[model samples]
Target: MKQLLTLSIVLTCLIVVAWSVSPGSTNAAPEWQSYAPPHWILGPIQGADGSEKIVLNNLDQITRAKIPITAFHFDAPDWQSCTGNLQFRYSDAVLDQMRARNIRGLFWVVPLIGLNCPEYQVALANNYFVKDAQNNVIVTDNFTGHGSWIDYDNPAAVAYWRSLLDSLRARVGNVLGGFYTDSVRPDKRNGVVAYGEAYALDLLDYTRTYVPDGDVVFKRYGVNTPSDAWLNQYAHVAYVNDLPTNFSGMKTGIERVFATTPLMPLPYNEFSGFAKAAPDSETYIRRMHWGAFQPVMENVPFGKQPWDPSFTPQVMQVYRYYAMLHRELEPYLHSYDQAAFEDQTPIFRDMDASRYSARLGNEFFVQYVTDYTPAVQIKLPPGVWINYWNEAEVFKGNRTIMYRAPLGKEPILIARGAIIPMRVYSNLTGHGTGKSEYALTVNVYPIDHSTFRYHDTTNGWLTFDVKGPTRRVALCTLGNVPSEPIIYRIASIAKKPDTVTEQNGAVGINTAWGTPLPERNNKKAVGRNASGWYYETNANRLWVKISTLGTDCPAP
Candidate 1:
């Protein structure tokens, strides 16, 4: 264990240097931003275990359906041989298709070098395999067959494996977007302590040197342990083990994920059968909604896509709605990313590890934990919060109640004076577009006074302030103000606004009389109430477009 700790320190220092010299190291984007976006950790889409033609068609169906996939990751039986050799049999046509669609390709890889393959003989001749106490080759059970792990501690082994990965990239093109570093702990190999963890670390070093722009997400075991403890500081993302798709497994998995807080900033739970199981549509929808509130979402099922024939119309509606909701929440998600990178704070966490409820420790009072049963209730921390869906449904915090939300509704709570940016669009592809047509709404809920710092690629970091007592709110651009027009939509306002004004970096409005043109295009094909900036008088929610405030009131 002590030797392992020393090796970890040395490797971490080297990796830190490699990370610093990587492509985007000097850029404004956070280091973690290299991976799939916060809301779209797409596809465990290990293509159907058949031929190359079947694999390409599976990917084609997803792209044709207009489903948003950030990256495409395929494991064994898709393109690579089962002997754990580096040989791939896929056509360049599939690579061209993926590139044309702007999707990243990720291949699954492990440290285990196949014992039966020709590479094993080469490794043995080169003395690159991990050896047992008797100095014989160490073989272990793997996905396809028995294999020996590359002795990462040996310089020759490291050079050989790194060359192999580089050779794979040469054959596969640069489409290889990093790897899924699988299984950190070896299957009880002697004469080596924590060799699996060391091997995974070296693999990451190779990825950083080769594909600096790509990402690496690991599985369980090695990370968070004492010998491999730096994972807490460097691991950008990780996921819970494959739990059963049933409710009990999901509940247990979610609880386990919550416990990984602050240590791992962006961890997710993998629930099986989301797309294929139509009978659990309701449960699936609820889980989907809950997933959006997570730090990162990975909802790929083994069978069909959610929008495919397997799902009912209603199921599709709910699934797509949450998917859109996830995209819409990107701006808010980045703040947490900034926090994790800059301050080592986990944004998606329970109030405490003991609690099951997940909380976004942002400026907003967002919590995503409540039972699905009728008359279900949730206890919250002390504060005043407004329901994000209805704005009228106000709740004083620190209590439980007979609050039963309707199906398909997630309990999104916003603090009274909180300000959250909204980038609204019809489809998933519109996320991070910064397009003018994508209505950017600044949602200010009922509050006294609050201030939030929001960051984006377009806007480096800006401060939004709300002075509730004086009925004044303003946006201060700490960096550059983005191109998207800022639309201030204040809810819980008592009276209507007669006029709107923009001054001192703040937009003021008396009433939303003739502002915020009714959405020119109705793009609610997903069945969500995609109402673009409307007010509910009885509900006391006033939504006035800030863009119209500075200019002539647009015709609705």
Candidate 2:
């Protein structure tokens, strides 16, 4: 659309861009805000209502969950009666309503053509479908009534699709944030569009041509052999497999291809309730708590997919909160592909700490965790990690403390000056420990905002926002990485329920969050007579006496 030169080749179904060194207009793509990652990863539709109301209503359930609806394939031969105008697929007004509440739509586009559909026929007449080695049209299904495939290599198809996208813009405008194809099959095999990665390359060009300028993604399962450097040329994100929990495998894949890709933290389904039967509250809390540290995160709700009555007040509150957080972190989610290339970290094994983080195409993500317990140390990207949610600055470090943090007790430590309003997780991976405020025993950091810069991760630059949020000590649940930032939010925490804590802020917890076992916030009570106080049995609050620390009063 910017009139930039795009590389075009036939059979390969590919296209490339030549970044004009000469400064052209610096127009940026749009992004979505206030939405959860996704819920129903993929499945068949029942007698479900695809109506905007039905979907949005159902989406209102998970106060904290953002549902990603994958519309049923329109190319199904017998789906005529069920089919609606493409305009109805993504209604602008409907999206506007959802936006008012902070919900996002993850659109799905399958390239396969339908044989019997007049639309597919029109596509072919306009030279749309992809061709085989022999130049014959390749269709998506074997069903007698389906259309042919849109040649990834077909210039005609690209143009038509691009034109179709214009219609989308005219009809829907700025409602959605991200775009991903159900599959990018040049043919029907569902493999990456091949012949030298033509499939993916062309798709990117297509996105630039039509859809809102933003991240374009794809889905992968099983031994997803990405042409790494090659695929990275196009795809900004990938929804990989839902099995084997290969965090390392995922990490390796990302490093080779898009090292900074944002992997969706979940069981792939994004809708399962694993925390339901978690061993303990700490385990449940840790999952969402830990995920909070990652660059990107997606959580599927139990029944918030395609159909539902409506969002209850509780669910609405949570959804609104997460929506606000998502907006705050919007600028950093530039390359969903580069953020979580593969899954290499072991923290994902806890089922509670499936960490997921992403820059809004914004900044670099750097952090250090002291064992996977309830400790964390992440650095904020240089620039003002604008806290879009509350308004504050993050805390810089070199400090420590001890506190009485019991189960269900999260004493929050907000820097009020770290550049953004930070949200502490009750658990990792979007799950909540049902606790309010995370409590830190000891914390040491530069609690000032004088030195941080804003981060832009996409171009890997340190571009400061001229008119960004200027609020200090903003309380936020999301952030954008800028420089070699560091964090100590979960530096040390309680591991159990009802553990003892000294009045001096030393905590002794015993539960599933048993991390940094060596560097606990509060160790066992010391020196008898007024040594330390204990936590109330079976209660979430901690109880400590001041007389316990003796001359160590004030804990130097």
Best by TM-score: 1
The most accurate candidate by lDDT is 1
Q: Write the per-residue lDDT of candidate 2 for residues 1-556, one digit (tens) a residue.
A: 1222264323233222211221221122101111122212221111123455544444354333532222222222222221211333634555565456444344444444456455666886777766767967765443323445555455666666556556545655544443444433434343543532454455555554443434445554422123433333333345443321123332332232222231222112221121222112232232222223334344432223212234234333333343333323333232232222221121121121222222322222322121224444333433333222222323333333332322222223333222221222333322112121221111112232112232233324232111112111111111332222111122111223333332221222332221111222222231111233332223222322222111111110
In candidate 2, which residue ranges exceed 4 Å CA deviation? Answer: 1-49, 59-86, 90-93, 99-105, 131-136, 142-147, 186-192, 209-213, 220-226, 242-291, 300-444, 447-451, 456-556
With candidate 1 superimposed using the best TM-score fit, by how many Å does residue 139's alpha carbon deviate from the native? Answer: 2.5
State the TM-score for model 1. 0.77
| Global lDDT scores for all candidate models | 0.55, 0.32
TM-score of each: 0.77, 0.46
Query: How does model 2 score by TM-score?
Result: 0.46
Residue-level lDDT tens digits of model 1 in 9-86: 233222222223222232133334333333333332223335777668756766664545556666543466645566
